[model samples]
Target: MAQPTAATTTSDGYAEGRTDTETVSRTLATSESGLEVTVFDSIRSISAARWNEVVERSTCGSVFHRYEWLEAIEAGLGKTPRHLVVEKDGNLIGLLPNFVVDIEKTPFRRLSSSYPGFGGPLVTTDVAESLSLLAEAVPELCTGRTVVHQIRGLDTKYMRYNNYLQSEGYEPYRRECRFVLDLTQGYGEIYDGMSKTRRRGIDRGTDGDYEIVEEELTRPNLERFHRVYEQVMDRVDGDGYPLSFFERLLDMRERLLLLTIRIDGEYAGGFLELLDEQRSSIHGFFAAVPEDYFGDHASELLYDYVIRWGIDNGYDTYDFGSTNANFENGVFRFKEGFGGRILPILVWERGCSPLWKMLKAGRSLYWPHRYE
Candidate 1:
């Protein structure tokens, strides 16, 4: 993707000479709380120290907010996502990581950062102003003739795009709630915090009949994990499939960990997690169980072990990623059972002339359900 034309400060504020081709550009703007917005071709443009400092100041931010994870996503996933930084004169205030997602080979397109997961801008209390700047800037930067600005896994309260959608007749979007296990008090305190029944289940799995094993996906395990992943996907009636390339993605990135529940030597269920320095985030990646084991709570076994392992290893947070159901669904309920707190995700999107019309024409394709 081409970079935006040089930004020139002018009486009108800042005049970014329009680009001849389509692209997303980072610009410097003096905005709310005396902050300036800086755009990047990729998340790697910012140093890890600067990126993480902003995360530490934000409420829902975690170690997964580090630049290395963003770099891993970009390296493993073939998408060129851009990262935008909002600075206060010189100090960092906020971040908006976005990408230009093409529809395979079609003329269709959209802008996203971290897809299939709830990762948007991490900011202090300046959400409204930070989002407003993005709302106005997205349309101008898009290069696609018709692009759907897909703001993924958004927490509605802090977002600005919902207003635009309301006027545009897009209706309210879906809600997803994540399960987070808090580790402030120590693992023992956290373990005792669980309900007696859940505690028993974890203890029961320890009888050796159900072995909760933490294994990095070796070459053979990767192949086995893929087989189980495919079965789970098929059972869920899913399409727009996760490419086999993702197995390679996990291998290439080497940041992925596969936590599995083995029932007397059989692969009953599993969960995938992405680890950085201080946090292990559970990507709602994939899990599979035999029909007979559904009643046995193999899924719960997987969750419990992953959470326990994460806490024991001195990690600060065990993120349950996001779910399409906010107040409902077994996914959310099970995670909540572990005493997880809630955090809202937000997305801010704006469309350009050509892309807006195209999105309307191909609305179905532009807004298909995303299975990440």
Candidate 2:
């Protein structure tokens, strides 16, 4: 049964049409802060001024949620996928841009963001209202369809609602952790706060006439990043997602930024970072450096350059991306030297098929490390 809305059935005691074909009117629900909720199908459907206002107010609102970023992802994909927007009193409040992906081409579908990771709902004082609206809207949008809605990299607060989704036959699949760096105090202070020894190493590496520049990822740079990326991937036997995937991303120049790190004319290292300048973040993507030269702390130099570049280019945060166990990886420890903090990410998913749901749940419980 659908949740009760403002409208009621006709006097004849019968609805006009079948639920599948029926046009259901949206009912405004009250937010914890006493705001009303509305949903939009596209960015053009919402007011830009109001949208920016909500982003400014929310902690999770960042450049990644920007229209330009979504457009670029769409352009890279060669088409736009379905988008969902939440508004209050004709003002933008939350946004979700997602596409359906096949798990293994068995007619099962999973919702995905333009990028691999996204925490869609705005970070508001009233997370319950925002989450409740999302939960209610999605099933309505899906209607008769049964599909897995994989909410990627969400803040831990939403985990409380996992049971609510599970009651609707959705399975909670996987959850992971992501690392982020705070860049609000400006780059200089950020650098000053780093561990003394690590800072000394980075300074020593760069003192011998070192320089960094944000270079266009032309054909040459792409090939280089790919080659180095292949080497890094080979170590883990990581399967490459596809070159065309990145090429398509690079094509959307307005929504993307590719920066290469060169040390004294040698290609020391490079990273393809997504920039949301308005939100002041440099999202970490592909990263590569020569393995042999790694001992020289070339990667650290590259990081220093990238963080500075992000700040200079008007970005305030440097997202360090995902990390495994805290002890094994020195990179995580190094990032902490720069005042990086860890953000918990949960992967909540609902399965379309009962068998599929069981299989996914078992795989998640038994073989968590392999999939991740």
As for model 2, its CA RMSD to the true structure in angstroms is 8.7
Per-residue lDDT, model 2, residue 124, is 51
Q: How close is candidate 2 to the true structure, as a TM-score?
A: 0.64
Q: For candidate 1, lDDT tens digit of each residue in 40-102?
A: 755655667888788767655543455655655565565566567776657777776766566
Give the alpha carbon lDDT tens digit for every residue of 229-253 in model 2: 7787787666554555567556445
C-alpha positional error of residue 47 in candidate 1 after TM-score superposition, expressed in Å: 7.5
Worst 10 residues of 1 by lDDT: 11-20
Candidate 1 regions exceeding 4 Å error are 1-68, 71-76, 80-95, 101-109, 122-136, 143-174, 185-204, 217-219, 239-255, 276-292, 326-328, 347-372
After superposition of all CA atoms, the RMSD between model 1 and the true structure is 7.8
User: Relative to the unseen true structure, what is the C-alpha lDDT of residue 19 in candidate 1, on a scale of 0 to 100?
Assistant: 42
